[model samples]
Target chain A: MNKNINHLVNETLDSFAHLQKVAAPDGLNERILQRMNQPKGSKEVYLFRNAQWLIAALVIGIVCNVYLAISYNNKGESNGTETSTISSFESHFRLETTTNLYE
Target chain B: MSELQLIAELKDGNQQAFIKLIDLYKHLVFNTVLNMVQQFEEAEDLTQEVFIQVFQSIQHFRGDSKLSTWLYRIAITKCLDWQRKNNAKKRMNSMKSIFGLDGHQDIIPDFVHPGIQLANKEKATMLFKALKQLPENQRIAFTLIKADGLSYEEVSEIMQTSIKSLEGLMHRAKENLRKSLEQFYKS
Candidate 1:
């Protein structure tokens, strides 16, 4: 048993001795060159590259929209108050002028 | 021309330089990957991928190591990645089988390397089986040294380790392989 095991181990260990190197398959270089010549970036990579810029632009647009909306709302509120005051004064002036004309 | 000239031309994206590079190292890359992966078709694909990667990344070569050394690194990495994916698929198949889903188990056929002599084919097959059982580092060290005909110094450089550490890994690999082979014979 010991001898058999020892023989097996030695045979397996020496199995690669005198081994020859195999050549690459025919036309492999052509295949590889073809693959290399294929347009470089895949759709996924292209999308990923542009995704960063898309996100940044989206964020910037949202921020600018929010700023404009807030300022417009503030201006709208102030203009509402001013328009109401002017309309009230104009109504009083019209009433006095009409009373004078009537007298 | 010279190695430096070839590298410079490759860096410059010269087509003739690229073809020359392919002609020069394709066999080395193929044989190394074949020895590691043990399947001709997969080896060929992985070898092609390695060269493509080399072409894409040549500008970053920096010439710190021999181009062959860098090629070996890329080829080995691609093989390891394939192995990892294959193992994951096997695990998924096993899980699906346990759940009684439609999962087909991969039958690992015996691999006889084209380069081995007829007399050694059987032993080499069993040896490869036992080799597949080794840890990644041990398997890489052993394959690069014994099967791929790389010198110890070259393997140490490729593996980026001291010769002493590589020796230890090789010793452990052989011991483990012996144990595995003994079990095979016993069975």
Candidate 2:
């Protein structure tokens, strides 16, 4: 029984001895060559492709900073003017009060 | 052109030499990968990948082995890597099905070799089914010797094993295959 089984196994495997080479699909060589001709290391390509977005982000960041600085400066100027006006009004009221007291 | 001259041109980045190299070895690489992977499309894709790797890394090839042997090593590595990934994917899919995360679909084994004779097709398919069940090393040893027609010495070099060990591997592969087929037939 073991002999028969071994024979059968050999026969079965031997049946595949003549298995021919399967041809690669058409244009496979061209496809490989074309890929080889193209660039390697896709990380660089990805970064370059997104360069516009990177530039846009940088520009937006700078514009936001400049706008905030301008608005802050304007706010500071307005606050300074309001403080000066209040002080002047307080001095004027003090003078009028002193004059009235003397009268 | 002589293989050494071709290799020199390839290392020097000659496109025509590269094309000639592909033309020369595509069939050998494709057939070996097809025998291992058992999927026509996947085998072709792997063959192209093997050549692409060769083209990119030909500079690093130290000429310690024959170019064909080097290519064989690359082809086998790619096939094994692909098989590992594919098996992992199947395991993941089965796990998903068990959890009811995905529908359960039977994964069919592909045994269709376009090269098989019509009279031997049924037996060949049965043999392939058993072949798939063998451990990776045994399967590779059996296929390289039986199907790819590599000599024991050549297979030893490609597998980076001593001749004595390779002989043992081939012997065990045949025994295991015979037992598997016996069980299959008895069933």
Candidate 3:
């Protein structure tokens, strides 16, 4: 049995013993050269990809700042108008009361 | 030009020298990788990758061994890495299926090595299936010896193992392959 196994194993492996070296596919050398000649880092691609996001973020931030500034100014103007209206009404009421009291 | 001159030229960014280097060793590297990976397209890609790596890192090669030995080392390492990544992907797919995340199908290795003779194709395929079941080192040693036709001493340098240990590995590999083949024939 052992001898049979050895014979079988040898026979099987012997088939592979003289495997003709397979030629590389056409254009393999060209492909390797192309890859080697490529620019090393994806720095340019990375910058291009992030450039869109960076611009979007900057625009968002600027818009938010502008909106907040406009809203704040509007609030301040409304508050001032309210205070002036209240003061004018108070002054008119006081003058009417004083005039009525005097009469 | 001498290999040393080629090395120097490659280090100096000489493209022609680089092409010469690739032309010289393309078959050796491709065949070694093909034997290991058992897939022509993947082997070709890996061969290109190995030369690209050599091209990029030629400056660090201190000439500790023959250039062929270094090339074999790089080729084998790339194959092993490819296998590991492939296995990991299989595992991930299996886990995904197990967790009901996705229905993942196993990758059937349809390796038809081009070098096998037409008469011996079936038997050689059986041997390759068995070879795939062997441990990585054993598989590598046996393939380097049987397929790449490297001597024990040369394989030792490429594998970074002593000759005795390489012999032991080869022996065990043969035993495992025999057992696998026996089972295969029985079934």
> By lDDT, who's the top model here?
1
Pairs that collide in candidate 3 are none
Poorly placed runs, candidate 2 (over 4 Å): A1-7, A38-103, B103-106
Best by TM-score: 1
lDDT of 1 by residue, A19-42 (tens): 899999999989998998788688
Tell me the docking grade of candidate 3. Answer: acceptable
TM-score of 1: 0.79
Query: If you assessed candidate 1 against the hidden native complex, which CAPRI class would it receive?
Result: medium
**How do the residues B1-187 of candidate 1 rate in per-residue lDDT, one tens digit apiece?**
9999999999999989999999999999999999999999999999999999999899999999999999999999999999999999999999999999988997979888998899999999888888899999999999999998889999999999999999999999999998888888888
Error of 1 at B180 (Å): 0.4
Model 3 clashing-pair count: 0
Name the DockQ score for candidate 2: 0.42
| lDDT per residue (tens digit) for residues B1-187 in model 3 | 9988888898898989989999999999999999999888889999999999998789999988988999999999999999999999888988889999985876667676788788877778878888899999999999999888899999999999999999999999998988888776556
Q: lDDT tens digits, residues B49-93, model 2?
A: 999999989999999999999999999999999999988888888
lDDT minimum window of 10 residues, candidate 1 chain B: B102-111
Better by TM-score, candidate 2 or 1: 1
For candidate 2, what is the DockQ-based docking class?
A: acceptable
Best candidate (score: DockQ) = 1
lDDT of 3: 0.86
